[model samples]
Target: MDTQSAKDTVDIDLGGVSPCGEVIGDLGDDDMVTVLTGMKLNLAFFSEKVANLRNFVMHLETLGVELEGFVLDREDNDVDVGCVGKFLEFDLLCGVLGSEVVELDRFLDTLYAEIADAGERVTSCKPWQDNLLDPEQCLKQSEEQFSEIKKLSASFERTLSSYKRGGIGM
Candidate 1:
């Protein structure tokens, strides 16, 4: 195809098509570099978010352990109605936190997979700057995954903060 026609063909954006679907195959070296750089940035951002979320989850787990210890220590006290009620509340909170940890673990697994896929796409396209690869799709998917994870992280943070204010472990 002629240069003008090639440009026209590439410019025809089809909604729902992968960002790099039609363009990558025809991209020049400079364009490939740009795309690769964007993908790298996306990877970096995703890795940082995942690390932060993991740290937060670890902190929550630690809090749960400490609260459990406190509850256990209180179990030996002389029988009292209020103490029993607090014990039940703490047990429920710990259970809910444990379930949240499990859910976060599952999410982390999926996020890790997305990161790995993005990394692989970047690696595969590095040496040859292969036109057939779809790094943009990887970038798009990573953005989406991180966005959802961020929302979940924020929600959990709010919930934990509310619990703290309510004197959960106090």
Candidate 2:
């Protein structure tokens, strides 16, 4: 196709609010490809990250429970053998770890719901002549959804770092 005709036909108006909530204009084939590809990549990354987080949470919970049991199994007289300090340490650690694990589980639930919603939107879109689907509403919804995931991912990373630094209460 000629450049002019291609340009004219390629323009797709997804008409919606911008990332900053302002009005948006037309999106060309290139723009659509960028958005679509970005959404796809975001979904993949988000899924993997969530999976890793869930595995980590599970491991931490199991270790926390086991540590609690071990501490409880120690007799009172064992404190003189340095078990007292160990028990106290495990008690505080488990409490903090348990709360963090709960928070992570809640985050996973919310993230999974958002991912499902985005997947539904993507599946609902019908393709154009060139086999590209660029529903404006879906793109906008996806952009918003992706933004949320990015924010959540950053927050999770910060929390993980805090934990590494022994800031379990974080």
Candidate 3:
């Protein structure tokens, strides 16, 4: 919660001992690699979400559907169109997106909370600054990206939820 403290930063310390046996630096390559891989996964996952959002938007336009409208069978995966990502609990968010979704109105608020939680956890990312690969810098950037994704995801979720809850399509 305290994002400003040093302890809250990305913990990518790859420290090693000097001739005097003092820990002089960090071994941060692992952290850098992990951050990079995580970003790629985030990108792909968000892409699916954006796609699904777009499809649902199109469906709304085509049917003049509004939120609170009668929804067809959510059991039909084909109706659950748009960007999909797994929602990780201090974990991963992509696989969760694949689950069958029902009740978009109630679900959007939950999705927003999930993204916000990711933003908080990533804010605590801590990688040492001196590494040649600069995992700390990578963590900073990744956190920013996660924050952005959270905002966008929350927006789409709400907009789609509103459309679903409206009775236009009914």
In every candidate, how many clashes are there? 0, 0, 38
Ranking by lDDT: 1, 2, 3
Give, for candidate 2, the lowest lDDT window spanning 10 residues: 127-136
TM-score leaderboard ranking? 2, 1, 3
Off by over 4 Å in 3: 1-20, 23-129, 168-170
Off by over 4 Å in 1: 1-24, 76-126, 129-170
Show pairs that collide, candidate 1.
Answer: none
Regions of model 2 farther than 4 Å from truth: 1-24, 77-125, 128-170
The CA-based lDDT of model 2 is what?
Answer: 0.46
What tens-digit string does per-residue lDDT give for candidate 3 at 40-115? 4544454455556445445433332322232433332333322121111101221122231223323444444544
Model 2 residue pairs with clashes: none
> Local error of candidate 1 at 33, Å?
1.0
lDDT of 1 by residue, 54-151 (tens): 56556655555555455455543344455445445544554555565466556546555654544444443445345324544554565565555556
